[model samples]
Target: MRSTFSAVFTIFVTLSVCAASPFTKRAVTLPPLNGKFDYQIGGPYTPAADVAVVTRDNSASPVSGKYNICYINAFQTQPDAASFWQSSANAGLLLHKSDGSLFEDADWPGEYFLDTRTDSNRQAIATILNGWIDTCHSKGFDAIEPDNLDTFSRSTNLLTAADNLALAKLFTDHAHSLGLAVAQKNTGGELGASGKSTAGFDFAVAEECQQFEECDSYTDVYGNNMLEIEYTDNGISAWNAACKARGSAISVIYRDRDVVPSSSKAYHYQEC
Candidate 1:
């Protein structure tokens, strides 16, 4: 009986270890960096062309058989879901100013910042995000694109790059555990080799790399594993010049800032 109990304990330990270990390296095929890509975070519409990769919000289902990427607002709150967090038992999870008022993302109304200043707050936020990651995996997403990674830059000096990077690592690990590749969303072209290596991102989804003249920063790190999105007319012009110079080896697309579906009058989608 003693031997049998020891054997059972060993088996349990091994199983636990397996469950806890995430795939450190990508075990799935990555979206082609040069393939036509679309940003559909606002809403999903019919694919207009030979799109190779597409990103959509977590609440939406993945496009059938495409290299679908799930978008999660990991570092900041979504504007529409303000009340969801405000009314939660973990309301304190949101960042607060010195006077105790909730900090907001000024440009994005209704969107608040998540507190990543301490281990407890980071872990609490991760706990909430892990559920979304699980849903993304279960729903057959090929990868995850956690938006607002640059939140620390807008954190009003209350947060640091290290704080956001630590939170990013948590999300990256969780996505990998479920066999989902993770993409680094905008770090403002400032993620040096150390930053990229520390976060362990599998790919990158950059916004306005052309307009910002930071395309090299992403391509230098992720190689052909980067997707670019341009929002404005000038940004589109910049994208055209970049694509013409870089050739078909770079995936580029243009969409309205909101990325709304075709039914909306504001809907806009195009590819390079």
Candidate 2:
């Protein structure tokens, strides 16, 4: 149930782009821990304050010479991109309920779940995602923030945690093969559960970890190599608590839930 960017879900990017094959290269350097950072997945702007890292949606280009994290909605369908999925070669990959209706994210009206129930569907989806990863590299991004890792939690009984992690490994391996660092999008509490090193994730992009008391879970694995976003508009109460209690190594920031551009009247962004 992502509140940000739900209303403007019409934006879509083509998934057909050239990409290098996966699992043939080594992982790249991660985003600097404890560095200034910004999350601009909604829109991009000049760095707010010498931000060492910035995350932007796939529709946007990477910031030059910055540790850019390309936002890839890997687990579920973005509200705006429903048409793209419907028309995609892997259209069958969309999950559906027993009644044959679309299985939505419940929290987000237009967002739908991607079916990772089988290895075949996973590979097909990976083909499209790999193309996106290629775009990140071709556009000069240093890393990728694959969103919707928690989609399985909303898939009713159609998907499992194992299903999601399997898909995640595919993404991480593909990104690493392209020499791009990969990030765990949320505190799924599955990192160590899989018996993989950091779940093969180079870092994390946690949203309101302090509010949920999941900060230690991430730092326990990725350490300071993570950035967290807290939103006042979202009724987040831990902003102050996080600021007061967080270690210097954890980069934290506050933004309007919408994450509007700095120039927008709805914009709200801050750092701690």
Candidate 3:
């Protein structure tokens, strides 16, 4: 009886190890390094044949047969969704000033920062963001670009860098679990190298990095996996400078500030 019981226990342990192996080995697919890229977050349109990657809003469908990235305003409330965050269901998720007025991003008037100061608030925000990640996965997106990670800079001390990084880990971990890679969007200058690993980001989506002269800040971490967008308003000089420096190593594109579609008169797109 003792021998039989010991044998049964050993078999159970072996089976359990086998059952857990897949989860331990599971990995998310990262985007192709230095691929031709397009940023269509303003609205989705078919990409040119040579384009290897495209980023679209979460509400937009992924472009077929390309490495598609879904954009999520993970750190703040969208201007149009202000009412939803203000609603009772999402109370305490938005940061408030000492006077109890809602704190808003000065550059983006209607958009407000999501409170990330406490574990409870971060978990609450994650519940809502994870649902969006689920949709991005369902829509066949290869990665996630959680924008406004630097919202802490605009938080006027109400939120700290640590606060936002904590929430970023939540976003990245959930994305990875669904086999989708995550981008550390436009916060390299602030978060630096350690923050990249802490947040579990696979790559980066850096806007106006050339204008800010911060391309190296991202490249030091993401290498060729960085997708750079230089605004036309910043002039071709910034774009030229970026291309001259890292064009061969990373994906670099010049786009209009609005990122309008080709059909629009304001549309502008160029690559190096």
Candidate 4:
């Protein structure tokens, strides 16, 4: 009986060790996406990279590509609030003021935050966003990159870090169950033990990691499970140096801030 107990204990330790392995060894080869990939002002879809993430509303114009990341405003409402996504159903979760005005992120001026504090609200948001993740799965995306994980920080003391992490875990588990890996978009700076264990995340879609001098945090926490997008040559060079020196596995790409279509003179794309 003692021997049997020891064997079971050993097996448990082995499984735990394997599960906790650093993100480096699990790195994947990302195909180039150095083309016009728009996050706003959606129009006709075109295959831009090995993967193209386009807004779901633009599904009318499909990008005939190998992999796609259908963009859903999973965390917040788009400027066109009432057209298709009615705010009435999600009124409780929508950010509001004492006077009932919406909380605004001026850069994305019109979009308002969703109150992700309560379990009920989070689950409600999860249910709706799960539909979007399912749509991406049905549409054949290799992965789902849910933008604005950091938006809770923009929640004006109403949204706690714990609230964001809990909601993120909800979405992450749902995505995986549907057989799609999800990414923690642009949260490279916020990863830690308290990050609620970024365990289930497959990889990261980091923007400007080099420019922020925060690439090392990602390389350490996420290991090679990263794809960096830089908007400047200096950032690209720094990315290469940091990633290469650590023998880390990372795909790096450069793009114009606008990611303007090839028809535009301001269009820019690069891969390294």
Candidate 5:
């Protein structure tokens, strides 16, 4: 009788271990996805009657009662960001053209690249972003979305994917340690590669993934855990068709490219 009881207990433990969520490693993927989560980057506010999960910029205070993704500009400098980086103090990470002009994203001109050549330097660079991560964890954020993992391609190969993998893991591991799930932003070059995601990212927050033919790459790995934000009508149509055909219940949100709030003329929001 004792032997039979022991065998049953062992089988139960195996099933429990296999059922944990990718984020907490304890819970399974949070309830059934509602399919209409919000993506608001202007920083979290009280949110309106329609907004589902509120996503704020990394600078805002985190809120509970909803799943929040802290948007940290991990790879680049701040938007309109020239004044932040002093040339005399931090120069190597800052990308410069032959004419000494900075490489700005135009949309987010403030961001600058961080030099991640050595572990020591990477940690030093991470120090700035880690504080924000710490704040996100403490402020009640459920997850983090560190943007610009693909900046290495933009860096003209001065930065390698290996450099990003190291940093990505560093950020995600630390976030997980604090009980916050981390997200991998765009990097079509190698995001779906086996075991290449150093971040141990729980879910993927892709921007215009449908418009770019990259949805397949992410959905293949994250399953329906991919939270897609389509910036245009055509993108929404394309993503929905693919998702419906597969019976995949992916969460989709539509926002302007700028992702401005409802108060602005450029304000755009939708869910399907």
Candidate 6:
């Protein structure tokens, strides 16, 4: 009886260790340094032949034969998915206002912030985002570009940088366990600077870092692993300057604000 009990306990311990091994260590792959890439979160289309990397929305299919980055709106609810979030099972994950109303992102009306103020809320949010990361892995994505890491700034004092970083660490840790690298999107000077190392972010996807003259903020941390996109509406000078300055060391592209497909009339794309 004593021998049997000891054997059973040993088996349980071994099983537990095996189950947790993946989360403890995995070989995560980072994006190619200075690789030409496309930002297609608006919609996915055929990337140019020279493009080595492509980013697409979570709902979109990965581009074949290219390093694909799956875009997940980790910080807030998508405008169209409001109903799903409003459902009882997931509603508690959303941040609420003083009046008990949903907190909406002013820049993006209809989009609501995810509550990361508490550990329970952050864990719940991480569970859903981790599922999305799982789907990205199953779809053959090389990495994840979690949008709105800077949502705390737009959170109207309800969410702090610490809250967002805590949630982001959950994301990066989960993504790495699945061997998927995570990108730090925007928030160049603040969270991008302070949280990049702590959160385990492998690289950065900056929108208009050049236009805002904060490209160095990302490059300083992510080095040549930075992927920069400058909008045409912001003027060509920013794009031109970025290309001339660190173009050889990093990936830089000019895209339209809408990021429409190449077939569209307003479509625009340039790379350096």
Clashing pairs in 3: none
Q: How does candidate 5 fare on TM-score?
A: 0.77
- TM-score of each model, paired residue for residue: 0.87, 0.90, 0.90, 0.72, 0.77, 0.90
lDDT string, candidate 5, 38-146, tens digits: 7767533466565446667765755555667777777776633444454554565566656787666544445567766567656655655666777776677778878
Which stretches of candidate 6 lie above 4 Å from their native place?
Answer: 1-22
Q: Give the TM-score of candidate 1.
A: 0.87
Clashing pairs in 5: 21-27, 76-112, 77-111, 77-112, 78-110, 78-111, 79-110, 80-110, 81-110
What are the Cα lDDT values of the candidates? 0.74, 0.76, 0.79, 0.55, 0.60, 0.79
Which regions in candidate 1 have their CA more than 4 angstroms from the true location?
A: 1-26, 233-235
lDDT of 2 by residue, 1-272 (tens): 24366323333355533332436758598888777888887777888647888988877888777788888888888766877888756579999899998788777788788998998888778778877887888888988888887777666678887877887787778888879988888844654435136347777788888877778777777777778888876564677777676646677888888887888998887777
In terms of lDDT, the poorest run of 10 residues in model 2 is 11-20
| TM-score of structure candidate 3 | 0.90
The clash numbers for all candidates, in the given order, read 0, 1, 0, 0, 9, 0
Better of 4 and 5 by lDDT: 5
* Span of ten consecutive residues with least summed lDDT in model 1: 1-10
Candidate 3 C-alpha lDDT tens digits along 220-260: 98888889998888789999999999898888999988787
- For candidate 6, the per-residue lDDT at 209 reads 80
What's the C-alpha lDDT at position 268 in model 2? 81
lDDT of 3: 0.79
Which stretches of model 3 miss by more than 4 angstroms? 1-25
Cα RMSD to native, each candidate?
10.8, 2.8, 13.1, 13.4, 13.2, 11.4
Task: For residue 232, give model 6's deviation from the true position in Å.
Answer: 1.1
lDDT of 1: 0.74
